[model samples]
Target: MKKERSFHVYAIITIICWSLAFVLSRLVMQELSSEALGFLRYLIASLVLICLIPLLKLRKVESKDLGLIVLTGATGFFLYMIAFNKGVKEVNAATSSVIVATVPMITALLSRFVYKEKITTKQWIATGVSFLGVMIITIVNKGFTISNGLNWLFLAAILLAAYNLLQKKLVQKYSAIQSTMMSIFAGTIMLAIFLPRTINEVQGISMQIIILVLIMGIFSSAIAYVSWTKAFEVAENVASVSNYMYVTPLLTTVLGLVIAKEFPEVSTIVGGIIILAGLILFNSDQLFSKKVRIKRIGNAELATAAQVIRESFATVANDFDLTLDNCPTNGAFTQAKHLKIDLDKGQQLFGVYLGKKMIGFFELVYHDGYQATLEKVAVVPSERGNQYGEFILDKARKIAAEDRIEQIDIGIIKENRRLKKWYQKNGYEIVCSKQFDHLPFEVLYLQLDLKDEVTNE
Candidate 1:
C-alpha cells in the first residue's frame, strides 16, 4: 500500500514540477536568456545525477548503446530545451502549455512508425480528436500563427518525442538513474555551445533570477527529471505515466492566475477542454489494444482456438466452397489437424486472448531451420474490428524472434488486395508473387524479416 502510494506521490510531484516549470521559466527569463536558463537548469539537475552515481551503484553500459544514449540526450534534452527556451518567449503561458500538450499523441505516432506499434482505427480517431482540440485552442488563442515561437515549441515537441522513444529503449537495458544521468550529461555538454552569449549577462543579473534558477534547477530539473525517468522505468504502461502531462495546461493556468494574475479567456478554456477530450478519447483502448502482444496459446487451448479459426475463416471458405467437406477449419479432424501439424512438426499454434476468452489464433508452420510460413490467421467473427488480425500477425513476429527464425512468409491471393496492403503496413514486404498449383490465382508471397526486429513483443 505504502509503496504504491509513494509511486503515485512521486509521479504527481514530477508532473507538478514539469508543468509549473513553464511559469517559473517565464518569470526568470525576464533577466536570463533562454539558453542560459535551460543550461543552468539542466546543469544543476546534472549535478544531482553526479551526486547519485555512487549511491545508485550503476552498471557500465555497452559502447554501441552509449552512442544511442548520446543521441537520446541530444535530441530529447538538449534540442527540446533549446527549442522550448526560444519558443516560449513569444507565446502566452497557456498557449505554450497547450501546444506542448500534444506530446502523447505525437509519441504514439512515432512509436507506430519507428517501433511498428500497431494502432487501431479507433485509436486513430482519438488522435484526430485530440489534434482537433489542439488546433481549436491554438486558433482561438492567437489565430493559429506558426511564428518563430510556436514553430520552436513544435520542434521541441518533435525532439522530446524522439528522445522519449529512444529513452524507452534505454530503460529496457539500463537503470533509470544511469540512463537519466548519461542523457543529462550529454545535454549539459550540448548546452555549452551557447555559454558565451549567456555568460556576459550573468554579472548584471538580479538575485531574483538567480533564486528562480536555483529553484528550477534543484526542484524542477534535478528532482523532476530523475523522478520522471524512474516512473517510466517502473510503470506498467509508460503511456499512463506520461498521460499525466495532459494536466500541465490546467496546472499552468492555475499557476499563471496565482503567480502572474493572468486569467485565461473563454475560448482557451473551451479549447483546452476539447484537447483533453481528444486525448481521453484516443487513449480509450480503442486504438492501442491491450489485447495485442500479451496472450499466448498452447494445445490445451485448442478447442477455443479452433472455434475462433472456424468463425474467422468462414467468409473466405463460403466464398470458395461448394461444400465444407474438405475445409480444414470446419470440423473435428481438419480443425484438430491444424493443431496436430503444430504438434507433429515442432511448429507453433497460438491464440491471442482478450480477457479470458480467445479472440484469435495463428499458426506458424516451420519450413526449414531459417524460415516459417503463416499457415492460418483467424479473428473471431464477433471481435474483428479491434485490430485482432494485426495482433495475431504481431504475435507471429515475436514467435519468429524467440524461435530464432529468420523470416516469416505469408501467401496472399492476388484477389485479396486489402489483406496484401494490410500485410505491407504491418512490416511484411512482398518477396515475390508466384503461381500456385493448387490455387487458381497467383499467390503474393510476403515475408517479414525478424533479423533486425528489436523486440519479441
Candidate 2:
C-alpha cells in the first residue's frame, strides 16, 4: 500500500509539472513566434538527446523501416508540435490546453475508424458526452465565427490527435527512448528549413531568452516525456492518469493572472470548468472497473502451442496454394526435418483471448543458428484491429531477445502488400525471396538484425 501510494504521489508530481508547461509555453510565446519557438525548442531537445543517448548505444533500424520511422517522427512530434504551438497562439492558454487534453479521445476514435477496433457502446457514450463538453465550452465562449486566427487552434487539435495515435502505434515497434529520439530528430529536420533566418536573427537574442529556450527543450520536452512514459507504464488506466490534465487549464489560468497579470474572462473559467467535469465523467473507469479477458498465447507455454499455430495460420491456409487437411488422431505434432521443422523449439506464440475462448494467435519461431521468425501471424476477424496484433508482436520481440536470437524474420506472401508494408513499418527487412514448399507462391523473407544491443531488436 505504501509503495502504491508513493508511486501515485510521484505521478501526481509529474502531472503538476506537465500542467505548468502550459503556462511556460504561453510566456515563451510572448517573445517568440510559435514556429520559431518550436523550431528552437525541438532543435535544442534533439541535440541534448543525441548527446545523452550514449555513443556506444546506437541501434540501427533496417533501411526498409526508415520511411516508417520518419513518418512516425513527422506525425507524432513535428506535426504535433506545429499544431499545438500554432493553436495556442490563436486561443487562450486554458482553452488550447483543454483541447490538447482531448488527445487520447481523438486517438481512440481514429483507432476505431482507421484500425477497425471494436469500440463499445459505452466508449461511444463517453466520447459523445466528452464532445458535448467541447461544444458547451465553444458555445459559452461565443458563437462559432470563422476567423483565420482561430483556425490554427482547431487544426492544432486535429494534428495533436494524429500525433497521439501515431505515438501509440509506433511505441509498440520501438522503445520509448528510440521512438522519442527518432521523433525529435525528425522534427529537427523540419525545423532546419528555418535555419537561415534563425541563425541571422539569433545574434540579437538576449541570454535570458536563450536560457528559457534551453530549459523548455531540455527539461520540459525531453525529460518530461521520459517521465510521462514511465508513469504510463505503471498506471492502471491511461485515461485516468490523463484526466489529471484537467488541472492544466487551471494552472495556466492561475499563472496568467498572477505572473502575466492578466485577468481571465468569465467564459474562460466557465468553459474550463465544464471541460473538467466532462473529463471526470468520461475517464471515470478507474473509479469502478469491469474486467474482461483478452486471451493471449506465448511460446514458453507449450500446452497451447498447437492451438496457437492453427489459429495464426487459419487465413494463410486459405490464401496459400497448399490445402492443409486434417491430420491423424495424434493431432498437431511437430515433425522435425531440415528446413522443414514442424515448429522450432523455444518459439513463443501470443494471441488475444476473450473469456475462455481464443480469439487470435500470432507466432514467433526461433532457429538454432538463424534469426527468429515471426510466422503464422493472424488475428481473428472480430479481433483484428484492437491493438492485439501489435501487442503480440511486441511480446514476441521481447521474448526473442531473452532467448538470445540474433535476428528476426517474417515471411509473407509477395501479393499481400498491405501485410508486407505493415511488417516494414514495424522494423522488418526483406532480405530474401524465393518459391518453396510447393505453394507456387513467391515468399518474401524479412530480417531484423539483433546485432546491436540485445534489447534493441
**Which predicted model would earn the best TM-score?**
2
Candidate 1 residue 141 C-alpha distance from true site, Å: 6.0
| Model 2, span 368-432: residue lDDT tens | 77477776565666556544565556556656766777688877778878888777767677788
Residue pairs clashing, model 1: 123-287
Candidate 1 local lDDT, 391-429, one digit each (tens): 566557756766778788888666778788778767677
Report lDDT (CA) for all predictions.
0.73, 0.63
Model 1 segments beyond 4 Å from truth? 232-240, 286-457
lDDT of 1 at 99: 74
Deviation (Å) of 12 in candidate 1: 1.1
